[model samples]
Each structure stands twice: as structure tokens, then as C-alpha cells.
Target: MSTLSHDERASLADALSRVLARQYGFASGRRQNLAIAPEQLPPIWSTLSELGLHAVMVSPDFGGFGGGADEIQLVQRQFGRSLLVAPWFQVAICAHAVARAGSPTQQGALLPPLSDGRAVMVLADRDAVELDAEPKVTQAHDTARGWRLEGRKTAVLHAGLATHYLVPAVTPNGGTGLFVVDSSAVGIGCHLSRLVDGSWSGDLRFESVDAQPLEGLSLQHHGEVYRSTEALAIAGVTADALGACEAALEMTVQHLRTRKQFGQSLGDYQALRHRVAEMYIELEQVKSACDLAAEAVEGVDSVQPTRGTAQALLVMSQSATWILQQAIQLHGGMGMTDEVAVGHCYRRMLVLNARWGDTREALARLRGDGMTKEMPGVAGS
Candidate 1:
């Protein structure tokens, strides 16, 4: 699908903002803690579905709105502003993957429910890790009954609320395969955990669990998909950081304008002005990086979109940390207080920076790209 014009995107953004204001109130620390309130999800899901946001990622052939990466990013940015905590991202990505890889029957069965928000899905990709080592997935296979799933997945966001999970597992031949597992399937288990942002997470266990192998879907192509997913996630997270930064900056600016120090308004101080100016510069840089990364994934070569995404992720991670720190410092001790929204945004940014892959991981991916020759058909080539 072609990209939406800036004005069209802005109209969607405005509508989303209005809905969020009415439904979620302001972005505050208190609201952050209440992210997954059971009572809030159904309505949120229905609202998004009605807005056609749920169908944005699905292809038109599947009776969806047929949106591409850019449209998805736009919606996610709005979601970030409210710190919206629905299972939409998980469901969208999984739906996209299934549409790309699943059999005709599977697509027909999954797409409609997902497009209408009647069901929720998550990607269970986390794996066990040895001390000081990279995480790896355990095998999940059973020759009997043509079923196999033997592994533990960690940090599965929204797992508790999801009806289905798309798990990436290693086949006996060492190839990766995606499997659709119903949450209610016997032998499947979950341990609920809390994220730094107060979102719901779980340690999922599949002990000889039955899974319908997603035929034709190969793990070999996942590198690009993984990178794209990370890029998309970083884009949304950067939006969250931007929202938090805006809130913090606004609060700080108001205080400076009204609060007097040494018989003068804090805004009149040269030092305070410089700090605010620095924050604005950093925010703009971060915003540009995010937009570029989003565009790169949508239009650039599929062989290595991660290169651009990694760059964006690094900038976003650093900018978020810097903005949060500056905002907190400017707010004094009250910034750390539970009553302050800055503290919550600060915490959320920290969590988002570490999710999918942290800054260190992103840097490694970026540097690793330098060792390889450019592939044919890439934008730069």
C-alpha cells in the first residue's frame, strides 16, 4: 500500500488523541500503573477496531484496510502518546506474519477475528539464557500426535490477556518455524510478571504442547522480519518518549514561567533557558531519527532494514534516557514522587529502551552490518 500523506496521518492522530483524552485521561504516573486494567481492554479494543486501526496491518485480500509500515507506525505513535496498553501490536505483527506465511485456511480463520479485535495474539520469542550469555529457544517437538512444543518463553507481554500466541521454535533440522498455539491448549502454562512500565508479562511454558506447524514459513527469513519488528517497536517507543518529554517539558516550562527564584522568574535565568533549549534540540533529533527509521523499513531494501533501524534505535535509546534524566533533574525531588508523571515516563522510557533488544544489542547489529558487502536491490545500491 502507498503511504498516507502527512495531512491524512495528522487527521488520524488528532482523532486518536481525542479518543485517548476521553478514554485514558492524561499521561500520568498513575495512569501508567493502571495500563492493563481488565475493565479497560474490551472497550479499547472495540474502539480501535471501529477506527479501522485493527485492520491496518492486514492485507486487503484478507478483508482488511491494507495499510503498510508507515500507517502502522502512525497509529503506534498515537498509541505511545497515551501509553496505551492493548494487545494491538502483538496481534498486528502476528497477523502480518500469518498473512505472509500461513495457509489459506489459516489466514481465513485468523484474519477476520484479528481485524475485528475479537481475539488477541502475541509473539512468544523469548528464550532461556545462561548466565552472561545470549538467550536461546529450547526445542518444542513431539512426533506423536504430530504435535511438539518443549520450551519456555519469557517476557511475553500481554500473554495473560491473549487468546493465541505465535511461537518461533527451532525445528529438528535446526531451521526456525512459527507455530500457532491456542492459550487454552493442554500442557501450556504461564507465569504472570510485571514490567517496569507496570504492563503485564508472563513466563510461558509449553510442555509437549500441541502446535499446528505453520507450513511454508521459514525462520531463515526472520532476520529481516526481526529487524523490522525491532524498528517498528523502537518507533513506537520513541513516540512514547516524545510524549513523556513533551509532558515533562511543558510542566517544566510552566514552572519556570511562574515560579520565582531569587525574586525573579526561573524562566528569566540564562542557565534554565539553556537547559530547556538543549532538551528541545535533543527531542528534535530523536524525532527525525525515528521518522527516518520508519520510512526506511517501509521503502528500503528488505535485505537489511536493520541497519537504518539500529541507528534509529540507538539515537532513540540515548535521547529518551537523556530527556528523562533532564526532566527529572529539572523537576527536583518531586520528579521522583509517585504523583509526578515525569517519573512514570522516565521509567517507561527505561523499559522501552531495553525491550526487544537494548542499545548495546542495537549497536552490535549496526557495527556488524559494516562487515558485509551491500546486497543487490537495496536503496543505496
Candidate 2:
């Protein structure tokens, strides 16, 4: 994974901001229906594709910019801020997994479409989104053609729009094997559902669905690949949460400055001002945690990558949730309604917090990994 230079980062951020501003305002986003059919791609998806945003995760070998976690943060943060609804998050996760683990032939076959936005693939992990929730849903059995997958994966992001699904299944040997299944394959059932944030996901039921291993990959190395990919997924969502928190705080401050109480602006009140400042401090903390998490996923930092991401998920989930809640409270009655942006922001944060691994799950992972010692300023009492 290659890190981008400061100049490249700035250039990419500026371009994304300009495009998102013109194409994805709150009003426009509000017009987007929560239920998107599998065959119907959003118009904005084509625009983003034209901008080559999808290429951020693919390697240069496959006609992409060869970006790592840093680039993903830049793109996803903007997605979070505008509450953009698309399958980019799923693409980032899937692309990173393939780039890190797939063989050359596999990369050649998959990477080009992925980077150019021609394909949408999602990871279907039983415990990927929720941690240790229930009985394992899916298992892969070896077949002459390749494999057969039987079970279900629920609440898969952009599953409706996916061309393929990357499923991790339990092999007979008790190790995880990653497989690719076409969304239109026989015996595959996809039931679309709207998420709280107006995005869509699918409940996938695989009944003897034909599948192939993620091409020439060694199962012995699967554990490391899975861990790193999970770390990246956490880091990616944390970046989105950071963006959402920033937007929520900004919306709150704007409301306070304009909305009046007893003919005095709400921002004029000393108590309210202090609360906004606290929110600002929390936002900064989230920013730091987000950066470190990205670095950890990229293996550019001293912190153990997987453990670092788990820690980040915990910290950001708490701070981001608090920031959004404060935003809603500051807005008074209007905040509770979907008519305003803060409510939407809060809902978005809730979804992000729950995804990947929520605060409680992250904490459990940290404790399980023996990371109980509190860092001096990082993990406060």
C-alpha cells in the first residue's frame, strides 16, 4: 500500500469537494429514494465514476491510481459529509481485499472493472458487520467446478447493486476460505431493504450457490489477509464518521448562530457556547483517531494494525455518536425530524457506528487482544 503525498491529497480532496458540492446537495440527496432497485444505478454514480473516484483503491497495475488508506479516507470523508449514497464503501473493501490477496490473473480480471466503476462487489462476512452475533450463516464446500456456498448474509451494503459477492466461508478443515459468487447465479436470493440513512442493503441467501475461490489464493495466508482487510474496513468507516461529525457540528453551530431565544441568539448563551466548544474538541479527537487508524491499516505506523483499528472504532464510535447527539439536542425540536440535516447526520452516525464493529464490540476486541493498558492521553478514564 502506497501513501499519497501532501500535494496529491490536497488535489484529490479539492476535486471531490467541488464535484460533491455541485452534484450532491442535501436537497438532492433528500430526493433520493431509500429503495434502489438492483438494476437501477443512481445518476450520480456515473458522475463519480467519471471522476475516477472508484480507482482510488485499485493498483496501478490495473489502471488505477494505486491509492491506499489515506486516499480512501479523503474520498469517504466527503461521502460522509454530504451523506452521499453509493456503493463506494463496499468497493473499497472488496478492492483492497483483492489487491492485497488476489493472484495476478485475478487482479487482471477484476481490478479494471472495479477501479473504473463497472462492477460492484461486496464482502459477505457473518461477523464482519456485527461481532459474534449468532450461528454462522454460510459454509463453503469444495466442488469439481470450484465451490458451493450454502447459507445467508444479511444487511450487506449495496448488495442490490453488486455484480459479485466476496464471501468468507468455513471450509471442512475449519479455516476460512474467501470465494466470489456472482449476484445473478442460480439459487442466490437477494432481498433489498432500506437502511435508516436512506441507503440500501440486501439480505443474501445462498442455496448451493456456485462459487470460486478468490483466484489462486492460499488458505494458509487467509487469516492475515482477513485481519488486514477488516482493519481497513474499520478505518474506512471511521473516516466517514469523522466527516459526519464535522457536518453535524457545523450544522449545530449554524443553528445556534441564527436561531433566537428571548431575542438573543442561542450562540450568545454561555452554556450553549461551552457545549459547542466541547463538541469541537471531540471532533478534533476524532480526526486524530481517524488518521492513526488509517495509518494503522496501511501498516505505516508502529501500532499493531488490527488492534489499532479496533481501538479507533471504539474511540470514534463514542465521540462521533456524542457529537451527533449534541448536534440534535442543540437544534431543539427540529433536530428530531428528518426535515433537518442534523437528524439525518445523527442517523448516519448511528449506522456507521453499528457497521464494521460498534463501540462495545471494539472494546471487547481490544480487551481480548490484551490492550487493557490505557494510553496516557489517548484512552482517557
Candidate 3:
């Protein structure tokens, strides 16, 4: 979408589809919780890196595929298709931050290893919700050895698995600065926890953490990075929601065809059919909005991103909730159990809605950006 030529889009989609088909099956197994000791992640990480997942997100200057928001959305949709469990989302997003802010020397040192999956990364921000909020916890100070970072960030995705973290902190001069810190640093501590979708995140505390600042980093680019990253995130999750909704719809359709009640199949009932049709209509609407949002975020240099991503999240989250709810209701009791597909889809929807902001928070953001509505809900990472 946006400035991407039709050929670029088609080639990218075709490549991703072919490479992910096998990994997609593995992801499905993980989502279903069918495998014992399913935590083996090195192979999964190696596969994604080898397939050029990280390369696709990186800039061409850094030996990357030079992709942007469109690529982020398409690949994320595939991840959503299988609920793929990997640290790739964090790695690509953090690497993007480095490419945008790091000096040439830093970029050359960092980007290649990440491209080949030899390193893992994640991003940590203090105020992930409000664009206007200043960092209260993490701050940096001048030190003879370099810069010393001190603060805490909770709910960091892939905190334990990452080899390094891209942390945004408030400088003593009242400006936000981005820095890279080794995960093995002495003063850094991490408290692990599980998310609703069965993924891991951590609460990190930094005490006198020595870090490498991105040379030539500017204040304007700091905000831009956050906005850009959030846009990419929304795009990725939108694709994921599309995949989950599609899968759930398929499951519901299959059930309707086979399950009989009142001596007739559910497909033979008019009311259920109407509900299914309504679900399909909403899914189509969300699918369209997500595509436009990805396009807008891709051209974020010119497009107003807050409005587009907020609008997309609002539409997708609403439709996802309703669609998954209908899928569960139609499937009856078994839909509530982990033995079925729709149940996992429901969990994923819950996690996605909770990410950043849900439907209500999205509407509030849209309103704050000059759209009309009453305000409500809080923001989080």
C-alpha cells in the first residue's frame, strides 16, 4: 500500500507465504498447547532470521530488505495466523529504532548480527500510553565512563530472551534519549511474568545501568520513533487480529455445518445464519480498515499516524471482540475450553485489546486528536 509498487507487495507476500507455511504449523501447535516441553525457541528464532524476517524490516542501507509499515503488517498477519511464539516482533522493532537513531558505527556493529539472528533485542519505554507524558522513572546522567541510566520499566516484552534492550529515558536536561544496554549488565534486574496469551514479559529495574547512547539522536526523532513504533505495532496486531478472526470464523462455520439441534443442523437455522453473516460483515470492515492503516503508517512521513492507527485499532478491536464472542457462543460449551481453536482466538483478542489501549481508549485518542467524543480509559505498555 501507499508508495509501494504493486509488484513489491505481491513479491513480499508470496515470499512470506511460502516460508511461513511450515513454521505456521509449529505455531499452531504452540497455540493449542498440544506439545510437552514446547518452550524450545532457538530453532524458531533461527528459522525466522534465516528466512529474512529481520532483514525485511531493516533499512536497505544496513543490508536489509528496506521494508516499512506495509511489511510489518503483512508479516504480523502471518504471525497472527498461527499465533507464532517468537521474539521477532521485539527484535525487528528495536532494530528499527537503532537504524533510525544509531550512528553509522553503531548501526554497522548491531544490524548485521540481528539480521542473522545472532542477537536478540527488545524496546522498553516508560510511558507507553500517553504521547504527552514525560518519563518519571527512567533517567540518564552524565558519567565519565559514558552515560549511566537509572530507572525501572515493567511489562517489557521478551525481556528475558533479549540479548540487549533499546531503552528510552529522560535526560537530566529534560530531553528524552534512547540508549542500548546489554541484558547481562550488572545493575539490571528482571522479574518475569506470563501474559494472558501465554507469552512472557518482564518487569525490569535499572540501577546505575551503563549504556551506549545513539550518537546524533535528536529530540524530535525520539517522539517520532515512539509514534512510528506504535504505528508498526498497531499494524502488526491488526494483521494478527485478522488471522484470529478468520480462523475463528472458519471454526464456527465448520461447527454450524455439523452440529445439529432440534433435529436440524445449525446451518439450517435462519437466526444463527444471520448472526454468522453479521460477523462476516464486521470482519470484512475490519480487514479493510487494517489495510488502510498499514498504508497510512507506511507513509507516516506525510500521513497523520495517530488518527489512522487509533481508528484502525478501534474498528479492529470492536469487530474482533464481537466476532470471537459469536464464535464462542455458536460453538456452545466446548468453545470455552483450550481443546478448540476459537478458545485460543478469544484469548488472543483479549490480549490485543489490552495492548496499548482497547476500543474505548482508541476512541478517546481519536477524540483527543480533534475528533468528537467523551474521554475515558487509561494507557499501558
Highest lDDT against the true fold, candidate: 2
What are the candidates' C-alpha RMSDs?
4.5, 5.1, 4.7
Shift in Å, residue 180, candidate 3: 1.5
Clash pairs, model 1 backbone: 140-149, 140-150, 142-148
Instruction: Quantify all predictions' global Cα lDDT against the true fold.
Output: 0.70, 0.78, 0.74
lDDT (Cα) of model 3:
0.74
lDDT of 1 at 154: 80
Q: Write the per-residue lDDT of candidate 2 for residues 274-370, one digit (tens) a residue.
A: 9999999999889887987887876722346767887788889888999999998999999998789889988888777655667787887777632
Compared with the true structure, what per-residue lDDT tens digits does model 3 show for residues 1-381?
233466977876777666666655644556533342223354466667666777877777777876677777777777776666677877877777788778899999898888877788788764322356533457778888889888778668767788898887767665566789999998998887767666777778889999988875664456556566667777878888998898789889999999998899999999999999999999997797688678657655434665788888888888888999999999999999866768878888887776556888788778774221111111111
Q: Pick the candidate with the highest TM-score.
A: 2
10 residues in a row with least lDDT, candidate 2:
372-381
TM-score of 3: 0.86
Which prediction has more favorable TM-score, 2 or 3? Answer: 2
TM-score per candidate, chains pooled: 0.87, 0.92, 0.86
